[model samples]
Structures are given as C-alpha cells and as structure tokens.
Target: MNKREDISGFYERIHYLAPERIGADKPHINVFERASCIGAVPFSRRDYYKVTLILGTGRLDYANQSIYIDRPALVFSNPLIPYNWNPDSSDQHGWFCIFNQAFIQQREGLLNHLPMFQIDADKVFFPDADSVDEIAAFFKAMMRENTESYVHKDDILRNYLHLIIHHALKMQPARDYDRDLNAAARITNLFLALLNRQFPVDSRQHELQLRSAKDFAKQLSLHTNHLNRMVKEFTGKTTTEHIAARILLEAHDLLLHTDWPISEIGYRLGFQYPGYFNSFYKKHAGTTPNEVRKQAV
Candidate 1:
C-alpha cells in the first residue's frame, strides 16, 4: 500500500506554509504553479483532492494503468486514488489546486457524485487548445484570489474549482470498468470507493465505520438487498462477504506484522468483544489469531 500524505507534509516538501485552518472546521484551499515544483509526485494516497492542468508532457501511473500524455490535459485526483506523476520535460509549467473535502461542501454533494472524483473514473482529460486556455483562466483566477485577503475569496475560489470540474466533464472520457455494465459499474465503483475510504485501521481509537453491508447500504442511500445484489452481480460476492474478506485480510496482516494485543486488534476491527473476534477469526481462518501470530514469529 502507498503511504498516506496529508496537506501539511505536502506543503512542507515545497518549503511553503500551509493554511492555518487545515484539518479544522473551516475550509482550506491552495493553488500553486508547477514552475515552483521541485520533484515528482510519488505513488501515495493523499488525504486531499488535487486537480492539475498538465501543459507539459508526462506519464501518469495509477490503478494498474500507465498513460503517457503528450498534449495539454486536465487530471483530477481524489484522496482515494494513489498515483505517480512523472514529467518527461524538465521545464514543467502548469497550475494545480489542492483542497480538503470540507472546502467543497454545500454544493449539493457535487464532488461525490462526479465521475472524475470516483476511484475508478477516467481522470485524464484531453481538452482542446481553446478549452485548455479556458481552463487556464480558471486556474489564473484561483492563483490571483488565493493570495488576496478578500472576505469572500474562498467562496469565489470554490466556484472556480467547480467551474474547472464542470469544464472537464464536458469532455469526459469513456470508462471500461465492470464490463461496461454502466449502472452496476457506477454504483459498484462508488461502493468500492466508500469501502476503501474506511480502511487500513490506522488507529485503535477509530474502529471500522462501515462494519456491515447494511451500514454501507445506508451510507450509500441504497436498500440493503439492492446493494448486496448489485455488489454480487458485479464482483461475484455479496457485499457482506466482501467486507468480511477485507477485514479478515487486514486481520491477517495485523496479526503477523504488529505486536498490538489481540483485544486491541479486535476492537480496531469492530469486534465489540475479544471472544467475538476470536470466534470470527477461528471460523474464517480455521485457526486462532494467536496461532497465526505464533507461526509468523
């Protein structure tokens, strides 16, 4: 798995100070020119959203696909997508906006429903030369507004961001996931993206949020049976089964790799009681968690 990068560390690398309101209730947005960039984007999951206008040529790697872009294009990357950007040219010049989820709230849930923000969505867009100039204008407006102290600057900047998204949507690329089962594929990708968002169990204090198929269904605003049926049709497994397999796989990793107590691991994986986790682990793995740890040691 790729390491996770947050906004603070991202700005630190470029020797710039992040906004004071990051990770807070208030929204935060930053705009930067690629000319000031000093390095390539490593393959990692970012805890923010990034939209870039790539005027310079580059190769992008993500989701097991490698695409080389020799023309001006727009690339949209969300926190769920881990990607590596390799610029083939030394003099890379473009504009990018980085913002957290909170920054784009109150737009009728616009970002979440868009294909460009989806994990499996086609993010690279080849806009015409005129469109590129048009898109560049949005970035220029953002850059100009980002440095100003105007009271409503964020509101205007936020609108500029959406304009870019709307612009790219006019030239949306074709998707090839889920065998072209458009309806099933869209919901499945959204479900899978939501499933992935709750992952890695990074903290003992934060248990799995979507612990069951029903929980996921409620979150996605779909009926439980419908969600399960769609997931099964698309992925060859019921939604609950997929969730269990992922939780079990993470349990295996934690048991083999970490010295955390079984009780703590169980709690982190959403088992309310240690005995419950033991039973589940034994039933799934045909052995206890301790036995797995012992064998690994």
Candidate 2:
C-alpha cells in the first residue's frame, strides 16, 4: 500500500484555490466544489477523513465492495481504509471537504462515537432530493465561512461538521458488517486504534514505541498469545502481520515522499540497523528500500 496522501499533497494535486489556513502548518479543514475543480484524479487512498456529497452519477469502490450512484449520495471516508470514486459522466456536481483527525479531536469521544466514521460502518448514504439540497446547503455555508475572517470560524465549522454527521445518522444505517460487539471485538478495536494512533511518523524525533506484537500486547494489558488470538479472530490476520503491513506501508510512503536516507527511514521505523531494514523491506515489499526510492525517481 502507498503511503496515504497528506493534506498538502492532496491540495496540490487538486490545484486548490485560495486555501484558507487555520494555522501555520497544514490547515485543519478544506472545502471545494466538485464541478469547479479540475478532473478527478484516479482513485487512491487518502490519509485524512472526507465527507463528500455527489449530486450526479458515479461508481464508488470502497474496500472490497462496489456501489453505483445514480442519485445524490453522501460519502464518508476515513484514514483506516482505501476508497476511490469513478464518475460515470463528465458533468459531476457536488461538494467535498477534507479534514485531518486533529480537526475533529477537539470534542472528546466524538469521532469514535460517530457511526458513519467508524472503520467498519457503512460509509455511503443515498439521500432524497430534499436531503441533498439540505446537505449541499451546509457545504455551501462551510465554503462561505471558510473565507471569512471570524475568530470563531473553526468552532463554527466544527459545529457544521457535527450537524452533517447527525443528519446522516437520521437518514439510514450504513453498517453492514455483523460486528461481534463482544469483549474480543472491543479488544480488537482498541488494539487497532492503538496501532493506528502511532502512524504517519510525523517527525524523525518521533520514535515509534509499539513496534511488535509483544509491545502492543503490553500496552493493551493482555498476554501476547491472548492478544494475537483476539486480533487474529477478529481481523483474520495475525497480530504481527498487521504490524508489519502498517510499518511497510509507512516505509513505502516515506521512501517515495521524503528525502530521508535509507538508514534514517529504517531507524525511524524502529529497525536497529540499515541491513536489517533492507532485508525486512525486501521480505515484505519484494524490493529493498533503495530500489523503491530509485523506482519512484
């Protein structure tokens, strides 16, 4: 898997116009009208969360499922999964806004509680025409306020986002997976959350603490075997497999996006030596880190 595209790269790819900055670093929220933007890029995984309202025909490929959209629909995307949208026609009309996890982290237990944003919940909603107009109005309002000079703009936008989420909640249930909701399921969800929390490796100084199944098991307060059994039972993959996959995904992304040397990338990913990192990457990625960087060039 490619490293998920970050906000700056996403803005650059879509040729964003007059981006409104909430801070000196990456902006927490970005809104755009689908029609005025350039042609849609080929589908790929995104690193941030997105809420999109498409008013035209299209096909949405989300994970292993495929949904065809002949009517207006609301789509929710999170960083934990990969998805892509294919418009059937050239005249696509809609609104989409992308925001990082920090934008929604202001309210405690907010993102985790939202059904639409849940990792295994239903992410796509087809709304009635009236509902489409209502939701589109909200996006339009957000776009307008994004350019305003209000001190409370961020607060106001967060409220709008919450309103949209609530509206979706009332529309229809999106969850299709028969979640266990048992102790095992809860543990698996927590383990995955802890695993995901240590992601994107924002800084070279940011060392990854949980690098192995044993490390995660310790953090989750479970014996290593119990942790592995819970994760494997819930996700159908061993705990180590999940950890290695995520680490390799990050390595690929860093290799392609950053100028960090192979040794540094290896160290940042918790490898003790460059040779060990090279062999690990080759075992999982079928190529050395240097080869991956060279291929990207």
lDDT of each: 0.79, 0.77
Pairs that clash in candidate 2:
122-174
Candidate 1 residue-wise lDDT, 43-127, digit = tens: 6667888999988888997634589989998999887656788988786788999888777664545566666785445789999
Quote model 1's TM-score.
0.67
Model 2, 215-275: lDDT tens per residue? 9999988999999998888768898988898788778777765788889999999998999
The TM-score measured for candidate 2 stands at: 0.63
TM-score of each: 0.67, 0.63
Once fitted onto the true fold, the runs of candidate 2 whose alpha carbons sit more than 4 angstroms away are 1-3, 17-27, 173-189, 197-217, 222-297
Error of 1 at 124 (Å): 0.8
Winning model by TM-score:
1
lDDT of 2 at 61: 71
Query: Which number leads on lDDT?
Result: 1
Residue-pair clashes per candidate, as listed? 0, 1
